[model samples]
Target: MIAANNLSVNRGGRLILDQVSFQAKKGRMLGILGANGSGKTTLLKTVTGFYPYQAGSIEIDGKPLATLKPKERAQRMAVLSQDEHVSFDVPVYEAVALGRYAHQQGLFAVKGKTDDDIIRKAMEETGISDMAERSLLSLSGGEKQRVWLARALAQQPDSLLLDEPTNHLDLARQVALMEHLTKLLASRQLTVVCILHDINLASLYCDDVLLLKNGKVICQGETQSILTRGVLENIYGTAFHEWKEPVKGRKQFSVVTRV
Candidate 1:
């Protein structure tokens, strides 16, 4: 299980995250929903040890996250940030192969058949096999995003942490990416923790939702329970409408007013 016990983070004398606690188990997908500046990114970074916390603890599979070596931690978890900047002019295939660095015996070790298989499979899963030879600087935003996701998948992580993984993608691509990721999570029993801006998408994809307001989790439960019109209206300060879908017979919620 991945867990945070009283996790807190302060930046430049300002408290960004405070006493936040949550848990995600294998086969579970946790969606974190919040408005801008609510510390969603900060939480993800802190959990992955990218940012230092002021207090509390983070653990993965009963081990302290801080105590784990860099390679040891990368073996268990992979993180996808909202924005990825690649300064190098590396080819896409070589970039994805970087994920195998942790599994390698040394810095200059050659990759074996297993590594090749993983890289190929990950590229295929993310639908980026054709772009494998393209340079990272030559691709569009969505394509670059998928390439990064493929790299993370190539790591063969037990858990994933994503910050708006589908941002800037078209509707079809967004749906396809989420479907692929959800399938991987279910089949591999991977724990997924993600920060999503679209509540509707989160409702459709995630098993559990954690609603945050001003850096604190206001409520958390099953997606269908916490994604009601009333809760969203209060949290986002907007008028909302909720109704059942005509075809699927599932609850459909939408924002109706700016205020």
Candidate 2:
């Protein structure tokens, strides 16, 4: 489990994240929701050790984040950034194999049998096995996005920190990605903390949600309880209509849609 208590951050003499706190448990998906500049990204960055904070503490599986070495940290949690620009072209398989770096010793690390097997499994899980031979630069945005996810999976992490994992996918693929995540969560072994813009998607796939406004957490809890009309309106500063989704019975909010 990953938990942050009373976390605070400052940049350029201005506070970007204020005493924000939340927890993501194993086998559960936590969605971070907010308007622009609401510290949504900042919170994730701080937890990932990308940004330094002034107060509070971060714990991963009962170990403080500061106590773990960089490699130890990467071995436990993998990140799939939204902007993964492949500067140099490489084959998909090779890209995914890079996730094993944390477990490798020595500067000239070669792929072992176990690493190769894990890489292939990750590619297969993400449905990108067929493109293993293809160059990263040759694939489309959606395909590259899947490749990155496969790389993260190859880490065999207990937790995933994703930033807009569905940004490049089409309507159908977006739903497919979320469905795949749900399937992975079924194992009750992985934790997902995703930053998402689509409310309906979060409502359908995430078990818990965190709503942020002006660097503070407006509300954080089960998706059903935290996505009420009043809470959403207060976060986005706009009117929204809330209703149960037809098939799954999850709550969904829209600014202009009706039940």
Candidate 3:
């Protein structure tokens, strides 16, 4: 499990996060929801040790996140960021194989059968096996997102962090990615913490939700409890309507806008 207690961060003499606290349990999907500049991305980066906290602590599976070595941390957790860029024209397969770097023995370590199998399966799972030979620069935005996801999956970590993964995806692809994540959560017992702008998607896929406003946590709990119309409206500064899906009986909602 990933847990943060009284976490705080500052940048440019300005507070970006303030005494934030939450736990992402094993075998559950935790959705971080907020409007832009609410510190959603900052929190995720702090958890991954990319940013230093001014106060409090972050722990993964009872171990202090800061104490872990870089390779050890990579082995335990994988991150897929919002903007993934490939500087040079590299084959899709090669880019995906980069996830295995933590597991490699040395700079010149030979790829083994286990590594090859994992890479292959990751590509196949992301529906990019056929594009293995294609250049990363040649793929569309959505395809690149999938490839990045596949790379993270190849890490085979106990926990995964995603930052606005559905940003460039079309409607169908967005749903498909969420469905795939749901399956992976159940089958692999993966602990996931994702920054998502789509409240409806979070409602459908998240086991827990954390709502943030101005770098502070406004609410955090089960999806059904924390994603109510009032809470969403307060955080997003917009109106919302909540209802259950007739067939699935899942709670779903939409923003009400004035035209």
Error of 2 at 231 (Å): 1.3
Taking the candidates one at a time, how many backbone clashes does each contain?
Answer: 0, 0, 0
Structure candidate 3, residue pairs in collision: none
Models 1 onward score TM values of 0.96, 0.96, 0.98
Question: Where does model 3 exceed 4 Å of error?
Answer: none
CA RMSD, predictions in order: 1.4, 1.9, 0.9
**Candidate 1 per-residue C-alpha lDDT over 131-219 given as tens digits, one digit per residue, 9 for 90 to 100:** 98999899999998898899999999999999999897899998898888789888999999989998877877888988878878888
Residue 219 CA displacement from its true place in model 2, Å: 0.4
**Alpha-carbon shift of residue 215 in model 1 (angstroms):** 0.9
Best by lDDT: 3
Worst 10 contiguous positions by lDDT, candidate 3: 246-255
The Cα local distance difference test for each model comes to 0.88, 0.91, 0.93
What digit string (tens of lDDT, one per residue) describes model 2 on residues 85-164?
99999999999998999889989988799999999999998899999999999999999999999999899888999999
